[model samples]
Target: MRPILRIFLSLTVLLACVMPHAHASVANAPGANLEVALVTYGPGDVYWERFGHDALELRDTVSGEAVNFNYGVFDFNEKNFFLNFARGRMHYLMDAEPTGDEEGYYVQVGRSITRQRLALTPAQAAALRDFLFWNLRPENAGYNYDYYVDNCTTRVRDALDKALGGIIKAHLAAQAGGMSYRQQTDRLMSAQPWLMLLLDLGLGPYADQPMNAWSESFLPYELQANLRRIRVPDGHGGTQPLVQDEQLLSPNRLSVPPAQAPDLRRPLGAAGLAFALLLVATARRARRVHALLATLYLIAAGLAGLLLLVLWTLTSHHSAWANANLLLFSPLAFLLLRTSWRARRGLAPTRFANGVVVLQLLAALAAVLLHLLPGTVQQNQPWILFALPVWLALAWSLRQAAPPASFAGAASARG
Candidate 1:
């Protein structure tokens, strides 16, 4: 295979290898019930034009007057607007900052998705299924720290719990933010049984320790017993924690044992800190390995940006064709730019590297900022989060892509 093909294949293989471990984490959790919500926005002249495309025509439902067809400028803006709104709702649900203007708009919308997900039509369910399948595939989805944090899982679970809909008021009441994270955890104690089970399974690395539900804080532990079936230390000397998977009794599956709820806060937090420190040390030591590290980080950042964009598009319930096209092509171009830069510059590529990393970090922050702005200000404007891809590409390309094979030779030649 060609060198470029080799690089691509290697990355692909690494992802594939890691996914089994990732999915193993999910195995204990109940599969999500497909529930979705579709909301429409009107009363703007430019709304239909921007979002309408490929047989989409906005018409006055009462008068039957056609306003726009196959995506006009207004439709585009409207789509972007709803996405911004949905993002705000997402923030509210997750106990993060809201981006929408009126506090009422954000809260009402969260209530609405919760409501709609409960009372979804067959058509809506089908649309959600299609949307999720296409987007949630390992190739399409990005693995960010948040992915491990379970934002997507939480969002999907919230929607489905609404769909199961026992006491509507009770479910919504349980999900409302503004109370402390601990309050939310107390709610979860009574809220979603599946999530609680998943929390207890300790399938993935995060599960190996106790996670504080309210603050969403992870506390790492010194002792292994507090966690679900961790690889216990053997009496004999061994450096690594041993692998042990002992299944616990379930409330539904077996007789309920009056057991103390595991406090994993310390161990989980410690693990996260350790993992984080390890990365920091690796990065510092691997300054010579900057190119490879940059490449990996770039790929990660690119996928993360794309996933966020897709979620933005879907929640807005707009035609994502244009945005999706941009999403895929943008990263490819960024990679190509990096390849070209590396091919030309030998031994030194620090200027481009600094420019790229700083730019990507800024763009990511900007996306979050835009997500916090009010819906009215964003209604006509395109969501700013999409801009991060450009920075991501630049950073990925500029970072030392590979170790200079002959640093000594280059220095000798210069001498």
Candidate 2:
């Protein structure tokens, strides 16, 4: 009798806990006249926020319950999170939360939000809702995140593509204009000069390759723009626009005017100034100053080369491989450190130093000529302009510091 009563009590508690959620799930089913929207958020001032964000908002008209499915959520407390991020293997998860709560957070942060209601058929909307719920399941929620390929915006684009049965991609393919990954990134980061420079230095030839329409959708704003132009087949031998309506849910209070065209004058001016200083140092026969400058240049080049090597081989940063900047900033420069030390001691230049000077000149020339090669995509002009003069100056300094030919002849004869 005691055991029977205990089992009955446990069964009652389980039913009470499960019943409400079970009822709610049924009430929010896809067939309940769902309204789907693509929610795009404007960029903020922070570095991470520069690319903006996006999510899929699903509202049940019957139950009046709305949920925002965001694909950008990552737990900082997860094991090996930072390690995975550094290795370019970041794992981001889909999080389905109340639409109001998500919108409130973005509103509080001053990020503008625009919602585009998709003109999906009843069957299409139901399928999309079902897919979103399936993706929200714990076993399927997390996905490997790639910034320029499989990011937050791209995920939503893919989800829509799935629901519409390839209509989005077909529409994008028919579009005319296109830009490379680096070019798009540069356009967005133009307002942040320092950040742009950093990204330019880190990115390689792979980033210069032109992006297809699907790839361009990695950007939230680009996805929004492209989606607006997409038309889905209407089954009556005609097509209809994908976006039914658009609404501005929130306005960015800190929005700034669009950035002006990118100007190379700043980089050229800085490089020119550096070249003038190097010329002055050489003309003044400032041995210590020249040696110090050479050391610093060599160190910078070696570090840049090492970083490029790591990006190419050790990490999953696909866009950073095949770097031509390595030609301008070579780790081989480190080999010249011994030569600089010997010259500072008033010793004759080593045969190795003479060889390094020739190699350095050849490397600089090669870097300058890389743009002429067929299918060559990297824009290494900035690096060439900055590094070429320094290399030339270093070569000149080495030549000046070398032992006279007559002295070399006399020493050889004595030997």
Candidate 3:
């Protein structure tokens, strides 16, 4: 009975040793048909889904098995996930799974899926499959995620470029169409006005520069569209289309609603109304109302300026740097709040208060002149238009309020 048990255990060990080689041999067997495709998913309603997603699909015709290589997976429970995300050091990992498992999630979320079958030779298809499997290994799976440069779509593009020995990039360059990063983002995000506003504020001139075909491939849908036009060398001195066939696997039912046009007039009108009230307050010597408005505006502007300062100096957000909006939303506004409160109490105007009013006027003027400068390309006109008149009105109201005679006499003596 012991000899029989030992013989069974030895056979089990032998089978384990032989199984992997057997599977590899079968997978690469001659005459085995293989297909490689790019699977792209349409954007969903969520903020994170606004960019869409893409993956590679490899189908083994002989085994009738379809595998999906996805590079978009990230664990929320990963060490320092949220912290790293804030620091612009988020990590994403590759995930290889059965095609059905991957498709199920996108289908459930109602995002449209499109597949573009690549016209790769058997050797090329095999190489891509091997490369994807190698990349799926734990050591090679993780990558630093950059939204515009090194995200999921770009990963798939780079992988295909690698498999094709730079042929894909060569084709893309030869047939490149120009589009700036900001233009493409704005077009996609046009359905979300608040998001568009935030992005416009956050992104710098780097996003405004024109993108090459390779840079544009960061977008999944753009890659899908460009793949149709790509022509690769056929090894026989002729070119063949990169995409052999294209199919729409699913239609997006959760369409993003169109963005409502920004009402620039409404904000301008509101500012105008506030200015009118400020004029009336100054005329009637309504120190309390004037002080209240000044304090509120100063506090709001101070906070906004501080946030922009942090985004510029303390973070890895490139787009928020060199913001001219700081000129309009000056942090120095906060320093004047004490004087505003003093005025509300009918106290004599201090020299510091007078200086702050002059500084506010100068800041407003600087904001207006910012757009005319060579490198200040931020579209802060709406903010400038809204806040400039309010600053001027506040300045005028402060000047209209006379200081006590005794305080003025003391100030004159000091001067």
Candidate 4:
């Protein structure tokens, strides 16, 4: 299928699911006839859907109708949507639609859907439903969207907590998550190696912090797991499991995120060493060849560093701010690019190029030294062990030799 059609269908399917109907059921008291369930969807084929999604399901048994309330709603046609997304101001809203179409869509897309029937008092259920209704109001639908803190799952989490008189938050707020946000990110993104590696490089210090259970609920799967352990008031002054009963509406047929982040550090280290060796080996048999490879690496790393800098200083992508990878892929490569290009053409690099090379090398060295600091904790081993050696080798190669043909030019230039 064409990419545009796929995205359009995915967005259509994603946005159109969740609950909508709230018609008055005949002979209803509070939520006496309404049933509430937490609906969790598993990962999908696309990258955005890799994090998964969820909604609250409201079923009015008396009326034989149900609605799903999803907070993942966004519009591609909204005014300045792409602009806002780039500014980290993505506008998302709580959306409601009948539940059946959503189920069909997910099943068709090979994503799983699990429903946990929530045991809430009639009052609690009704209050939660009403709050969702209030949230769907035109003025209220727009919400501050942050992937780590206040996305779709977190919204459902907060709404559920409010309905339960804050017990969910009060109970789980103290519990530390099993993994850091970056670790969770890596686990979910493991299926996409290149994307995962890029994120590992771009992510900054904030992604390293351990999320408390409350914050971790931002993940639909985490919230699903955590809720299984929760006991809410049964309205008779006793407690019962938050999930009264569970049902798998549809089994996941697509790839699922691993329980833990994959470890690639060993292979990364090996690859880095091999690449460094390749540079050294080629440096002897082929000067222009070595210079060509060095120029490419320098250009790629330099552009990446400059992009990271833009994200940190000019963009609101907080996760990209303060990226330590900046040290390894320093923008100084751009300054050194000319000299590397010169060497590729059998021309000698200038003395000033040596200073640029030293500065770049020192920056990469600092990245490794950061691990020795008291509180430095960005998990960048893959980047360091993988990319650092390439930079160092290139620096040494630049300083250690000039093409033999450029000897007279080098002498005259020095003279």
lDDT of 4 by residue, 253-276 (tens): 997788889886887889888888
Which numbered prediction scores highest in lDDT against the true structure?
4
Q: What is the TM-score of each candidate against the true structure?
A: 0.26, 0.86, 0.79, 0.89
Tens digits of per-residue lDDT, candidate 3, 1-415, equal: 0001122322332243246643432235332377889999988776777878899988767666676777887777777888888767878877765688678878988999899999887777778777776676567878898888888899999999988888878877665555666566666676786687566555656676556787789989889988888788777999989998999998888875333334443665477557646754653367777777778878988887887777788777676677777877778888878876776665645788788778877877887787778876565666667777777776666655665666889999999
| Candidate that beats the other on TM-score, 2 or 3, i.e. the better one | 2
Best by TM-score: 4
Range of the 10 consecutive residues with the lowest summed lDDT in candidate 3: 1-10
Tens-digit lDDT string for candidate 1 (1-415) = 0001122322442343246543321111122332222222211112111111111111222332221111011122333545554443211111111112212332332321111112333443344333333333435433221212334333343333343342222323343223222222223332344454222221211222233332131111101122222222233563222212322111121122122333434444454344334334443344435445445545654564454455445543121222321332234334433643353344344565455456545645654555466641211012222234334443443443445567777899999
Task: State the displacement of the C-alpha of residue 7, model 4, in Å, after optimal TM-score superposition.
Answer: 19
Candidate 1 vs 4: which has more TM-score? 4
Give candidate 4 misplaced runs (Cα > 4 Å).
1-23, 26-29, 345-348, 403-415
TM-score of 4: 0.89
Error of 4 at 318 (Å): 1.1
Candidate 3 wrong stretches, greater than 4 Å: 1-32, 171-179, 190-192, 257-293, 343-349, 360-364, 367-370, 374-382, 401-415
Inter-residue clash pairs, candidate 2: none
The CA lDDT at 245 in model 1 is 32
Give a tens-digit lDDT track for model 2, residues 1-415: 0001122322332243236564343224555378889999988777667788999988877667777777887666778988898788988877766788778978998889999998888788888877876776667877999988888888999999999899888878666537777777776787787788767777898887766677778888889999888887776999888898999999988654254435554675477458646854753366677777778778888888888888888999898988887887888889998777666655656888789879978988998888678888887677777777778777776767754666889999999
